[model samples]
Target chain A: MTDVSHRDAGLLRVDTDECKGCGLCIEACPPKVIRMDESLNPYGYRTARYAGAGCTGCGICFLVCPEPGAITVLRAARPRQSTAPGQQARP
Target chain B: MSSEPEVTWEIASSKPASFYSTYERKDELQHATHYCPGCGHGIIHKMLAQAIDELSIQDRTVLISPVGCSVFAYYYFDVGNVQAAHGRAPAVATAVKRSRPGSIVISYQGDGDLSAIGSAEILHAANRGEPITVIFVNNAIYSMTGGQMAPTTLLGQTSTTSPRGRSAAHEGYPLHVSELLATLEAPVYIERVGLGDNKQVAQAARAVRRALENQVRGLGFSLVEILSPCPTIWKMSPVESQRWVRDVMEKTFPLGVLRDHTQAAQSEAVPIPPPPLSMIPGIVGVADAGLPAEMTGDADVPALDLQVRVAGFGGQGVLLLGEVLAEAGLDAGLEVSWLPSYGPEMRSGTSNCHVRLSREPIDSPLVTHPDVLVAMNEPSLRKFCSTVHPGGWILYNGEASPEDCDCRGVHVLARPFTQIANNLGDARAANMVMLGALLEIAGNLPQSSVDSALGRLVRNPKWLALDETALVCGRRLMREARAEVSHAG
Candidate 1:
């Protein structure tokens, strides 16, 4: 239950330790945002690693990855609210 | 002075889109008022609209519509869309995609627009792995032009060009465009389905979504080759065409994910980051098999035209072996087309591949005349030994001595193909072993380049050495022959 982070510049991101490497994250990333490392984890599979910075961050990969609590993303930072004068002037 | 030039015009519905309107999903893109009844174009248009909406690419989307019913997709998507020339969606999409990498580009084409005139455009586009999605619709004949034989037409499907069943002796079988496209790795996803039945509809949706998703990921090429029904031409009503596409087209084209990026992601166990579209030109060599060698044809001495066939039971790896030769030719810059023929009976019956190599674009897939043919069993020999051209070479695999094929105009070598395969450990390595012999007698391939090419296929050094050894042995045994007709002279 970490924040739904959008890593790779809001494309994709995941926590490496929780990854069981079942490839659910890989299968879910449509643009192939997840990749496997060469070293196999305890499950003997090279776990899915965050692939690239091009991810559009549609949240499909985050939703479909079967491993629970494996992937996390830092929310895209939002700017603070504008002042009333700026808002009223439609700036 | 308000100068006015007299002009009068009237535009009607052209042909009411009753069929399209009926099939329209109310929840999606309501009141989309363009397209005609019994038009394959509209289905693709709707699918694209739904995909854009679901994927939310609408805000950053660009649709390249060619001169077909789909040109009106712009009317529905409410996003920027351009109508390109006839069969030039790839070129147009190429420009749009390169200029605006953030926008999702969709190229929609019909049979004539894609397979016939613009074949080269799409091939080179996919070959380059442009970050674009192509929706190729095959409806057998060209409905827009009053029905002519398109490159994707089935063997028996009658079109204007072939009033009689498409004679393989002439027109040949329908082009398995998806199968051909699968050979290239640049495309991150490729799938084929028929829109005739409910099952195929669901499968098509999955494929479309998969392709669209790949785009969202910024993966390279994604295409969904759909076999839609053109009732206006096939002498069938819209419903009948749908049924025919379901029963017949699906049987021939078979519905499935030809190449699933997601599956590749699974097996790969980790995601490989795809480079940006800006670097595509510099990254062409980054494909699975790196850029091929330079093949300037033998100009001083022309090479003999050859048709090569590799045949065996389904699991025999015969096709892979043939691909090595084709890639070798590709390296040599020789024209090549690899074709396979099969029904429900693949393993139990005869399974063969057709490879035609020339100095020019291949006009036909059927190898009417083969200069060299490989038969891995008695059944293949029985079927194709007669088809070999007079003075052609035949390679067969037999446990003991050579079996008499009793055909004319060709020389047959019945070697212990299985025994050699056993020595290699991996029986599938037999195909590569067979390739060695094929290159030897045919002289169509450079053995060194082929060895280099095959190296990319097998990773295990032990297995790799065995294939090389088998190739060397077969190369040594090849019966030498004098050049007949060379392309140069």
Candidate 2:
């Protein structure tokens, strides 16, 4: 069975194999969180990759991506606070 | 190292859902298109496919692909597809949409197909206000046929034909299709868009959708002219091609809605009602005279099937001779067919016609090997003499039969038909003289029928009299030849 790995990260994942390295997305990203990787994908064109952090999940990069399904954005969810037995939970 | 799943939103991709599962041209590359990377066709095709999907007219859609780089469009679009001849997409689309009014017809054309060979087709189709959508892709060069100079080739642009760069004095300026069509009164919507930057691509997508939508709304003709990028032909990288379209092409062709007569077009879209079949005879001025007596079948006439080929130079009335024979055969109650062909030169060009008359239902209108060859000139006689069937007749309009044309099992009557007509007072009656000679020899149709047909065709009494005399002289000549043969035997 194919594994569906779940992760919590406020970041953008580039399907490096599908990218053409047109760099339009790099220009479109307001926070400048995307960059072309030095290593080429299987197709030989240098593909885009997400920087370590600073992604606002604005999705402008996805909006400007000429190739469909090449980039996906995952937003960081609000952290859950652990509630003890005697602790009053804040609304 | 395990973490909770993160919430994410999926943005719509540029590829449309309406694209076929795999391009028919290549089954292995399902995700890949045939177009080169960064080609604007891929983007334009995506925009069109998105529009088709958004409108949900995939079932009712018909895409007409002409001869061009996008000729393979049918392989990608999951809809009814029709491939048209080079520069004939608009004409084929017009017929398709007119016959199937409920369907959505899209004529996709390139600069070469639209502006060059098919200019008249597109212009007339738009002028007629045919309810169809035309997606004109302007790439400034003919990419499909090896980057030849197209009508829309920009000045100073180099191509295979314009290797030294196009000069304004030599190649003229690029054609503004949207502006040209806007000058016409009937077109409902005309817009020019570009597949340049992201913003321009978005606008081009909207324009494509609007043009298709206008057809859906039953509005009149709509065209979306897109300035697309041809990276391979332009010898530029994909990104550079897009940039060139934005920075360079836009300077020549500004993007905007040239005209939008949507509301006015709606009123004109009412389908023209066809006249009743009963009114056809009246419209053609034959209501009083019903189907010719021959067609009504008052037979007892001999079983006759005649095929006649008439050929001559342009001003010689060759087609008229065939028409007269065909008309007389019709009057004689025989099924008749006449087909005429002429060269491009209006005067002094070769002209020819084939006529068939048969008691039985005619098989083919074309007479491949005619039974009777009436050559009104020496060239036609020499050219077609070999094609006549054995034991057939050759009536050449010359002084004497050419040497080496003494083919056995054939009768050749070489006479100066023009001189004979001149003796009869009008050289124009030469065709009539040849017809009379043919009728006298064949006797397939009665002389009275030929006379009546001539009367119907020739309204001028003076020419008719001269033709009648020419016909008699021709009959006499045939009789004299037969008598001389009998005397010699």
Candidate 3:
């Protein structure tokens, strides 16, 4: 079990209202952390949900998802100390 | 514990900016698209929108949505949208791209619409190397109008139209569109991708972007054919349908880049802009003669409305006589139209023409009932005499009018005009003599207009002189005939 305070390298958000519950994202997630919810959405179909841990954030789920807004992937920012001297900051 | 650095998350992937915030295609589903739950069009649309957003060309992009399920593509895409007829997306895209050369035009089509109905259009567009992008979605079967067989359907696939599972002898083999198009010389890029799994989806996204990028760079034609899955129509779960594409569909259509001439291809030639309205007359070699003085608000000029039907054998200048009449009407500042009907044979075949000269704008060129019938032969006279209007004049070329023709209330001037032309110089001038008599009866067009029209049409000076003499003789014949009738009365 992962500690609640520990931040993983990646995070994922699944909008229940926009999800059609096709399970493509769940099947495509490399970490196998996404699952179909037991409850139905407003349109009466099961929706995908993040399992709260072990996300690598490769963004394959976002690529395979049919709905544009259903899946959003986020990657953890690198530590400030690891920044190279001549490297430009991301905008 | 205090030494650990705090970590924050930033968005890696989200919805693209090219899609509308809310789809207003229907009242109920404002937030959702019209596609089925696991439909491939949604995924493809997202990839396309992402490309448009990344390229920063959303404002100048024109998406030509074709018939089939994706006909409502305009509802989702925020770019300039045009819904084309089934299978005509490529042709429509060509026109749009040529007219608005700066705009990025994309033709989105389906298997039934592209490979089946619009095969010729796509072939020609690609062959010409039209600087446009084509996104072809092939799902093997037609899903929009129920699951019917498509041109790209796999050989053993069972569709509503192919209930017994398509056989080679019955339906023939599946069409390889990417390969077929690659054989053409003009296309700069052609690739086939699939949406069966994550890897394929990622590759498809890259191909879609590259196809659009080629258009942005002004490279020649580029096409990306996507083998998409239809879950509902295939009667399989979404996952199983996708698996079918990878396992079964891939065997029939191997995925790869079929053609890549983008590196060697130069930017296509800029299309010539259409001429301005003022230059059209000069370009077409028509003198910009505005309406004549007599045509504008003149109360004394009779309201000229003449419908003339001229018919004869093919070599008897049937069409030329009609052309001269229409040209003279133009010179005289009247609205004119001439329609010719003839057989395939160049000579000795039947030919006819309808000529209309009206003061008002002519509605149609067809003259079902003419004010006068000029028949240069016996068969033509018998055929067209009944169609002349009541009290109209019939100028027949024979010695006398046919006894069986029901020329009840119409006036008949039956003269051997061919023999008269033979005495003058050539029998071919008989049409000119008939035209002269007809002009004398109408009395609307001036002799100067006819002379100018004849000068513009007749190239040989010898034939022109003989035709002029024939015309004077014809006028004399008509005058003498009228005098004799008055004396007999």
Best by TM-score: 3
User: How high is each candidate's TM-score?
Assistant: 0.41, 0.56, 0.62
Can you give the DockQ of every candidate in the order shown?
Answer: 0.01, 0.07, 0.37
Can you write out model 1's per-residue Cα lDDT over B22-67, one digit (the tens) per residue?
A: 2232233233333332344554554565566678777777778765
DockQ for candidate 3, C-alpha atoms? 0.37
Put down candidate 2 lDDT per residue, B45-110, tens digits, no spaces: 877887998999999999999887788888888899999999999999987887677889999999
lDDT of each: 0.65, 0.80, 0.87
- Residue B31 in candidate 1, Cα distance off native in Å: 5.8
Which of candidates 1 and 3 reaches a greater DockQ? 3
Q: What's the best-to-worst order under lDDT?
A: 3, 2, 1
Q: When only chain A is evaluated, what TM-score does every model earn?
A: 0.60, 0.73, 0.78
> Any runs in candidate 3 off by more than 4 Å, and if so which?
A1-6, A80-91, B1-6, B276-489
Candidate 3 residue-wise lDDT, A2-53, digit = tens = 3322346667888888888888888777768889999999988799988887
Report how far residue B116 has shifted in candidate 3, in Å: 0.6
Chain B TM-score of candidate number 1: 0.48
Ranking by TM-score: 3, 2, 1
Over the stretch B1-489, how does candidate 3's per-residue lDDT look in tens digits?
546676677899888889898888544558777677778899999999999999999999999999888898898899999999889999999989987889999999999999999999999999999999999999998888789999899998999999999988999999999999999999999999999988899999999999999999999899999999888889988888888989999999999999999899898767786666788889887766676565353453345899999999888998999999999888888889999976421113578999999887788999989999999998888778889999898899999987888899888889999998998889889999988888887787888888999999998999899888888888788778778878989
| C-alpha lDDT of residue A28 in model 1 | 40
